[model samples]
Structure formats: C-alpha cells, structure tokens
Target: MSIMDASGLPATTPDSNQYSAIPTTPSFPPPSRRVSYVASPSLTSLASQLPSNLGRSRQVHDLVRALGLLQDEEQEGQGGRDGDEGRASSPPRATILPPLKVGRKEIGRFHDLDYVDALLSPKTVVSPTNSPTSSPSSSSQSSSDDEEESDSSSSPKRKRFKPDPTPTSNLSRKLLSLQKFGLLDDSPPFPSLAPYVLALAGAALRAAQSVKDGTSDVALCWDGGRHHGRREAASGFCYINDAVLVILSLLQQRISIPNPPLSDPQEEDDRPEKTRKPRILYLDFDVHHGDGVANAFLSPLSLPHPTSSTTTSTSSKPLPGTPQVVTLSIHHHAVGFFPSSSLSSLTAIDTPHPHTLSLPLQVGASASSLKRVWEDCVEKVRESWKPDWVVVCCGVDGMAGDGKGVWNLGASEEEGELGWCVRKVVDWKGGIRGKVLLGGGGYNHPNAARAFANFTSIALGRPPLDPRTPIPEEGIADEDWESFAPSFDLEVPVGNMRDLNSSDYLDDVCQTFAVLAERIRTI
Candidate 1:
C-alpha cells in the first residue's frame, strides 16, 4: 500500500537500513513491526481549537515532532549529517496517514441519525422558546420601551436592539435541537464542529482499517478515544463515539486459529481448527469510567455461575452464543463522580453481562496499585479470552498533577508506569494479531503531550526519553511557550498523594477476579 503524508500526496518510502544514533532498549514486538500513525494538520488544528481542549492537540503534535518521531528517514539522515544537536535517536519511522473523510453513513453507524443531522447541518436552528424572556421579540419590545422612556427623560439617546445573524425562527429551533442532542454546556458546538467530528472519527477509522488490512501490526490515533459519546447524546466532552465505531468495524472481519492446548492431551488431538467470529477486547485505562462504551455492548445474558454445570462448554469453541466484543474499563469510581452510573461500580461483575467489566480504583492510586491490578485481573482475563484484537484507551488523566485526576501514575519506563503497561500489551502472544492505541482524557496539556510522546517512542520500539529531557522549541509557537514554564521538561513525576489502594483492597480484587476468570474459561 502507498504511504501518504499530511498533504494527502504520496510520500517517498524511507530506506529501511538507516538507523539513528539514539540508543534503544530491547522491548516487545521488536523494531521491525510496522506501525502507522493517523494524523494531519486539519485534524490537529480542528481538535485543538475546541474550547474544552484548547491547544492540547497542537501541543501533542508539536512535542511528537520535536522528538523527531515524525521525521522521515531522509530528514533524520540530513539532521545527523548536519550535526543537529537536538535530534533524539530515531526509532523505526512510522508511516504518516492523513485522516480519512467520514460521512453521515459512517457516523450513523454508532450515533443517532437525527443527532448527527443537528451536528452537521448548517441550517439547524436553536429554539428560543426554552428561554422566552431572551427571545428576539421580547428583546426588541424591551428595547422600544427603553427608547420611549429615554425620550421622555432628559437623555435624548435611545437604546436599540441588535439583530441576530440568524432568523429568530431558525435560531430557536436550532437551540432546541442542540439541547436535545446534549451539546449545550461542556460539548457545545464550535465554529469547526463539523470538521472536528469528521477528522477525529475518520482518524480512528483509518487506524482500525490499517490493522484490519494487515498493513500495520499496530496503529496509533492520538485524537480518537472519545469514549463518553452516547448513541444519541454527547457527554464528558466526547462528541463522537470513535472507540465504539472501531470495535464495530473490527467485529465484521473473521480469523481462524488453532485451539489452545487442552489439559487433556487426548482431547486436544481430537479437536479440529474452526472458523469463528473475531473477538475484540476493548480495554480502557482512562481515569473516568467508559460508561458510553460499556453501555453500548452490555448484553442481556448474565454470566453463568461457576458451580453451574450447564455453563461449562464441552468443547474448546466459544459457547453457542457468546458476544464477540468484551469491554474492560479500569477507572476511578466514587459516589459523586462526574458520571453517576451503576455500571461504573465493581458490582458490574455480579450483573448479567460478564463481558462488560469494571475495575474501580480508589483515589490516589499509584503505579504499584495499577501493577497489581494488571498482573492479577487484566492478565488473567486476557489468558482466558484470548482476544484477536486489543484496543487500549491510554488516557493520561490519572497521571499525577492532573487537575481532574487524583491518582499518582507516572509516564516513565519503570515497571508499573504507563509506558510499562503499553509495552506489555504490544508484546501479547495469545492469538493476538493487531493492536490499536487511542487517546482519552488528559487535562494537563503539557503532560498529555509528554505521555503520548513517550508512548510513541515505546510503540516504535525506541528508547524511552528521560523524564528530564528538555522541551525543544522547534514546533511550539512563541505565544504558547509560556505554558511549559517552571519545569520546561518532559517529566510527569509522581506526586505526594498517598496511594489508598491498600493490600487488603488489592487482595479482594484478586479473589473476585479469580472466580470470574474461571467462568470466562468455560464461556
């Protein structure tokens, strides 16, 4: 397949043998694995301009470029020849892909059509009926009254009403529509709304496509993991459900593999290879629970009890009717969290949908806490499910110093850090063929940039940058330079918050999942 750059034109392939001077550590999926990155100027510009994430996309793009990850082989060679001191050791070059153009049909796959229309249609009106006191007619009448009163007084000047650009009739209807679609406060419509939705959704779709087509073993779309988007409404600053759409797209394809070795040697020999639906694992590591995604795939069937003989399958094949998609969201949960959903609690395991799982961490969860959860719960589930595709939502909001987060996670390469978790997923061996890494919630713009840049290095099998690495000024604008003040480095060091996930809490988690793992094996 041909590679395209940000300009949408065909880009020349870089020489495969050229290597950078930067040293790299031996990690999972060696440097030879093909990794494709989905991005473009249009995507970043539109995404960064959003009110909630102002300048964040631009920050992430600039940092990744400053790190030299986006440089072509020719650029790297030229930099080395010129003795450019700022360039870091280059890892395997990732092919750049412009965001695809997603239309109403693609978006309608996950969102309600009427809601999509309200978002895309320029003529849609916002109704004034909801606020009668502020209606144009009332404002005009009020202005006339003011003018009459002023004329009677000593002041000769009269107040006049300024007309709205849109007609009152149309504006009122649009307002109502916006409210219906949940686009008023946090997710209000912006000037670049249409393009932002199209670009972000398209970026995610293209990433998933690259993996499904086997053009890339791993795909990265940093602008894509908007998990809180609902089927008919927007929530938690997420206007599009890109993660859900990606999972839906992947479920259509099928793959065949030999069954895993059975405990009984005779039974293993008798089993035959079978063709079945591709199983997808949607693993969310966002600070906030992925309620939209979990709700999307919540099935009606309950998990079979561990002691029930009827729940056990006689053969290695999936139970007669098991779901193809499984969602596991590890997030923070509290009584008054942003999203108040029963599904976000640990009690979800007791519900009917065993495939939809939630692992809620207490406040101030540190790397050690996450490491325990990974080793005990996540790994056990992976072994039992043996998923074909793993979609990871790498949200950095849980990292220390985030305004919205209380957890103390870091982005370094240490054993329980964010990079370590990503490395583990990239190297997974149980029938896994492709991986998709997506971006989610991160309020601290600079740290968000730092975390993703670090992840890109890990994804390319390159050496992890020192947390103290200086922030290069190459791509950042003069006006935005002050945002990186104080530290001016790429470090997101752990804070002083005490990790509340005690050993007892972790032990309970392990015991609970130990039984759930057995049930998954039978299914």
Candidate 2:
C-alpha cells in the first residue's frame, strides 16, 4: 500500500526491499536544513544491553524502519512540507549516520577523572580490607527491574552476568566502590558496561556535531538522552549524562551575528567584533525532573543583573551577563518524586540560579495543561533567551499507559499533545539555528517505540502517522507480536486519570514565569 505524498503525488509504498543496509556515514555538505538520524548496529546492540531499557533501542529502530521514514533522499521527491502552506521548501529526507566512539578526554570534560576511570575500566577492584559488609542487592530492587526482560539477548561479543548478591572479600570491596559512585541500587554494573556507555554517548555527540557543523538542522539520537547520569555518580538508570555532554559541545560553538545598528552613528568607529558565545536551551519533557542536567549547570552567578548595569551591549542584543546555557524542566513533582532535589521546584524570582528553571505540575496533567505551560512558560523563555540551539530530552514516560507516569499526555497530532510540542520546537523561527532530540525514560517498550516512530516522522517533514495505523508484520518476529496486544496500532491512547491542575494553579504558574521571563530579558 502506497500513501500520498504531501504534494498530492503518489509516494513509494512499504516493500520488503526497502529494508536495505543503512548507508555509510558521508561527508556532509553545507546545511540544507536536513534531518539526520544517528544509529549503528553496534550502537543499537550495545544500547539494548542497558538493564533499564533492554531491547528498547532496537524496538524503536525497527518501528522507524517499518514506517519507511528512513528512505533515501534520492528515492522520494522533497515535496512534503511542514507548518504553513506558503513554506514551499521542505527538509531533505532523513538520513542515517554512523557515530564515532566518545574518547576518555571528552568524557572527562564534565566528570571527575577518578569517576571516569572507574566507569571505563574493565574491572574496578578495591582492597579486601576496605570491603563493606552489605552487598548492592541488599537495597530495594529498582523499579525498572520489575519489567519482564525481553526475549532478545545482548550482543554476541559480550556475556551478561548479574551482580553477585552475596559478595565475599574482594568482591564486597568492589560493591562498596560501585555504591560510592551511585551505580548500585537502580543502576548496577552489567557486562560490557564500558562499551555501552561509549556507544550511547557517541551517538549523542554525533548528533550534536551534525548540527554544529551544518550537516543538519535537526538531529535525532533515539539511543541517547541519559539525563539522570551525574558528574561523579549514576542515578535513575542513567550511566552517562548524554544531555549534559551535548549541551557542553554546543556551548563551545560561538554564534556569529552582524553588528546591530549603532545607537549613535558617531560610535561606529569604536565598535568591537560582533560575536557572542552560543546560547543553548535544554528543554526536558520527562515525567521526572531533570535533576542531573540542572545540577550540572547550576550556578549561583546566574542571578538577574541590575537594571542600571550595561557591561557591553549597546544594542538590543542579550547582555554579556546572561548565562550561556539555560535549562527548563517540566515534570510531575510531588512530595516524594523519585528525584527529590530542591532544583526541581518552581523557579522563584530571587532564586540563586534564575536561568535554571523548573515548572512542576500536579498529577494527571493533560494536553491542555501542557499547552498552557508551552504558551506561557516555554515560548516566553525561548523568545527572551533567543537560543541558538535547542537540546530536547523527549522522554515518553509521561505518555498515558506508562506504569510509572502520572500525566495523561498522549502522542497524537492534536494541539497540545506530545507530538505537537515537539513540532513547535522543530518549526520554531527567529534565532534557533539547530535542534537535537534525545530519548529518555519510557518503560512500556511498545508504546515507547510507537511514540518515537511518530516523532521521527515529524522530523522528516512528514505528517504524523495515523494513530490507528496497523503494526506492520514484515519484519516483526512471530513471538513478539503479542507485545502489541489488543490494539496493535500506533496510538498511545490517553487514560482516564483526572487532571488536577486547577485554573488557579495554572494562573499562578503563568504569573510566576512572567516575572522570570522579564528577568531573563534584562540579563
């Protein structure tokens, strides 16, 4: 069955032959506003080894391929368009690129050398004398471990082994070291942990490089977005904080703009070079707050500048005192949210880190609530900061049907839905030069695959797949078909959860962010 292209032309149908080998990474020319997907067999295989998201990487990849979203640019005419009809030009068909492994030096940029060494080492051993009496498993089992493991196994090159529940002597000491690094409870050291870290981290780095080098305007790395990883320790099933790494990489690339018209023509002779460090906006849409990323960039110096202070800017450009990077996380924050950091709370006017903002919502937030947040908070901050690059942690755990999620967010194309929010960022105008989309927490594997595949379609300048679209039987294994269950379609339907965000609460959110946005403009 063939589908109609956006130009009302007959488009290619999904055929068995379409599943050819992904092309090799090429020397990308100048930016064409194309979309590039970072993936490799090894990368996906290694990512599947993650205990928290076993086989999820491969599942997302397969669904994308099944949808024919990865077709070569040469195969289809660049006729499809997004947003306004007058926007005749559309991005070229999305391409797949192989990733380069992240080096130890790159990993050390944000993490301590000692922590980096322990993470990359094949085996970290401490003296038996320093051994602790308790083993790592003595703590409560991670919520992720409750999910049934997929029938699919890890890479053939690596052997999988569970951590020793009852350690003795030297092994006990090793467990103690792991605990110190926050790799014990929810995130345990598994076989080939080093390779997994390198692969997933490399994919995210490659996505950032593609955007920075003008290879693509938007880059997607479904295997990336480990936002819970920390500088010295791992948390929330994240071993490497790829989101932080991506931000740091983009921060180094300065933005070049022509000098604004001089307020006084007489001062033109004394004008300096018109360049400023690139500004990055890290927008996270996970169910849980992005504590790792917010903590990584936390700075007491991010407070708003005095009104009279004019250090450099004589024009309407951002003040030199403004932070180079700003992060805003929208998540469900209750009394005992998994990450109970002070940074996860709502942004106060006099907060030490004004640029590090959080918009916490109550249980059962729906599309309408998200719409309010987007219009009042997200867009307001984006306009004020005028970010050069946007790094989005698109965690689908907030979508309905997630065991751990409290929000009633859906993956439909309707206004205020998850897909709609993503499209808004993709189609953002003004100073946004590029975008990077990374995967995060999503427990239900089938639903995660469905949501990500839809997101990939949006990035490819195609309309979102109909929620009722049937799951293709071509490449799916017989035994895995049952995973889709009753409604084996693309839809992630909204549940019956009650939206507790009252108008008074939402009004307060808007009023609070209004003050913060003005403060950002002054900075």
Candidate 3:
C-alpha cells in the first residue's frame, strides 16, 4: 500500500529565484533559540488557562509529536513510497518547505511582495542590536566604522523567502518541512510562526502535486493558529496566519485548492496542470472566526485588498489557482447581542490588514445544531466549488467538555459531537491528500489539546487513542482530579465587543472572531 525510498533532491537548481532583496547573507552567528513559557499564577497549570475550554495550544507541538504528527523521521511506508501507490520519481523536495527561505527580505512579503523586498534589500538591513532578542543570527560587535556601515544598510530589512516545491507522496516530509519554517524569525509578533506557515504552505503545494501525478486522492494541510491578530497586527498570541497562508499559497501555486468537495469529480479543467490545490474546506473549530484567514480568502463587504506596492508580485498574481481555497468557521458570536465590530472591522475590510472577520451571534447550540450549521456553511461549498484539496483547522475550544466553547456542542451528559462531526466529513473513502491541521487555543487545557491530537489521528484515517492526563510524581490524586473537574461552561458573548468598537484592546479580542478557528478538509 505504501513504500519508502531514500533519494536526496537534486542540487539546488539554478532556477531558484531570489525573492528576498538581501544579497547572499554571511552566515552570522546564531542567537539563542530558547523559548520560555513564562507562566503567571493566573495561567499556572496550562490546562486551566481556558476554563471548561480546551487544552494549552502549545501542548499541540508536543502532543502531535507523541502522536506522530510531527515526527523527525518518516514511517509507515507504502509498499514502496511514502504516500499512495505509484508516485513518479520526482526530484527530492527542497528540505525546507520553509517560507521561501526566510531572510531579512522574505520576512515581510505581504499584500506587496516588492515592498517586502525594499524592506529586506541589503541596503535596508537594520541593526539587530536593538531587535527583540528572540532568535538572532550571530554578528559580533563591529567597530564604530562597521556600525556606521551597518546603519547605512539598516533600514528595517524586509524578510524575503524562496520558492520551494514539496512532495505530495510523503506526509511526514511535509510535517518536517512545516516545522522547519516554524522555527524562523519574522518581524514583530510574527513570532516564530512565519516559517511554520511557509512550510505548511509549501506542504499544501506538495499535496496538490498529487493531482497531476495521478496517484493522490485528497489534500490535507495545516499550520499553527495565531488568532487574535489584526490586519498587520499579530494578536491572539499568533504571529503568523499559517493556516490561511498555506491555503492561499496552494491556490497561488495553481494547485487547484478545492472550493468544496463532492463524492465524485465533476467539471475538469481542460487546461494545463491538475486540480490538486484541493477543494479546500476550511473548518475553524477554534472559538474564533479566524479573521486574518477570513481576510485572506474573501474580503468582507467593508474590507478589500488595499492599494498594495508593486514589489509584492506574488500578491498580484493569484499564484496558479483561483477560488481554490474555501473557508468556514463555527464559533460563538453575539450576532445582534451588542455593539457590532463586524461592521467596524468593515471600515477597511476592503483593505488587507488581517482584521477581516465574520462571526455568528449564538453558539449555545447542541450537537444537531452545530452539525447542521457546519454543513450549511461548509458542506455546500464543496458541492458548489468542487475543490480538489481539503484543509481542516481543528480548534479544541468547540470540543464538548472543553471550557472555551461557546455552545455545549453536546448537552445532556454527552461527550460532545465536534470530533464526530469532523470524522463524518473526513472519513470519506480513498481521497487523495486528505488532511486536518490543529490550530487555536485559549486557557491551555490538555483535554482540548488531546482532542486535537485525536483529530490528527482521525484525519490520517486512523482511530484516535483516548488521551491520558499525565500525573505528577505520586500520580494525580483523586481529590485533585475531582477538584479539577470543570463544572461551568464558559462562553464569550459575540456582540458589542471591543474589536467592533475600535475602542477595544487586545485582551478582549476573543469576541472579534470567537478565538479564530480555521480548518481545511480536502477531499
């Protein structure tokens, strides 16, 4: 059914275009890669961050690893290759699905790729001397003369990326590629997620390749979820819109991002290439509407693509796909409940700034309601769009039994139907590139985290294991367990929020998009 082959990719080809403005970077000394999770008393036991909500989001990096979503090595080889049967002998994919090779130039490629270039050109290299000491490449203290030269070149260097192809036959390779990018440093709040999103985007492109190879079935791609971000502002603890970027990237690559999927193929493009961009069914299970992602796909009535600089040629061209990425969100909103930020977020909705968001008024529905809503908003897209790929953004907040969920998803003592709903949609038989990605988080709850872990297994067409809550040295005490049992369901009201009024601050942003969830399920 599957096979494993060991062949390195061809030497970096000459066609490797230079997206970054900076010239060949001298390998500078690396900076500290230490990531510290400074937990305050209010957020002590990462699990308790979100009340009946889900688990700590950061836990996903670890849990998925334990569950094998983020393995360093590939496994479960098909009879011969890593993916579905019959993969062509394409060159080994670039080891880094990472965002086009991040450097000063590639980091800021936004609505305007060229503008990003201006920022990253060697002439604009800014001094890292005062940059957020997150992760810095090594450049020692140069003499005063050198400092001046550095300053002359230092004008807030824009980060540039390289164009890399990915292999659709291999999922682990995709994951590894995704993680490598996850480690890069982008501008402010860009956090370490830029590379991750770039890698995920590259991975999505890889999966779409299957459509042409004639061996792929579905496309499943995902990336880190960074909700709480405003257009140009990374909020909700997410620095990069990895989930959205991956989908957009696939579409740009002309990977035929599936709009919505039908049980069978319908209209075929008689043009060159294939439809592997995946009929992307974006499902944001996170409590939020995934505003940044929403903005990327469809600009709200009020918001649209702003006048972008010419440098961003990537943005000018729709890559290679059109309407390839379709998105859907299931989260809590105060439709008519209060002050409407949806309308406010509209002022510049036409402008691309990440604040693009959509919300639902009420989320207190039970399983049936949730399922009906999901299908209404999403399933129909597949029928209409007929996307070749599917990307699922699994947010644990909506999982029943978690605290951050706006609705019970399952009341009357039920375990919740979120996972079941996901399974029902993803379990379609023998689809190529079928995949689900984990995203978003509130108060870190391991249960929510575990639910995500389970979803990854299910997305892979495997059953999930009941996750066990790890205990302390003496084992979790019965009394402690009982005390830890969540009693109330905490929900954020959808309307009259700060994000709507423009008078709002970051802490209350959750209401803007219900914790921003984006899930892409490719069929």
Query: Which candidate leads the pack in TM-score?
Result: 1
lDDT for 104 in candidate 2 is: 82
Prediction 3 global C-alpha lDDT: 0.37
What shift in Å separates residue 302 of candidate 2 from its native position after superposition?
5.1
Error of 3 at 512 (Å): 22
lDDT of each: 0.76, 0.76, 0.37
lDDT of 2 at 60: 78
Candidates by TM-score, descending order: 1, 2, 3
Per-prediction TM-score, please? 0.81, 0.80, 0.47
For 69-93, candidate 3 gives per-residue lDDT tens digits of 3212232122112433222222111
Tell me the deviation in Å of residue 23 in model 2.
16
Lowest lDDT 10-residue stretch of candidate 3: 32-41
Error (Å) of candidate 1 at residue 188 is: 0.8
Instruction: Answer with 2 or 3, whichever has the higher TM-score.
Output: 2
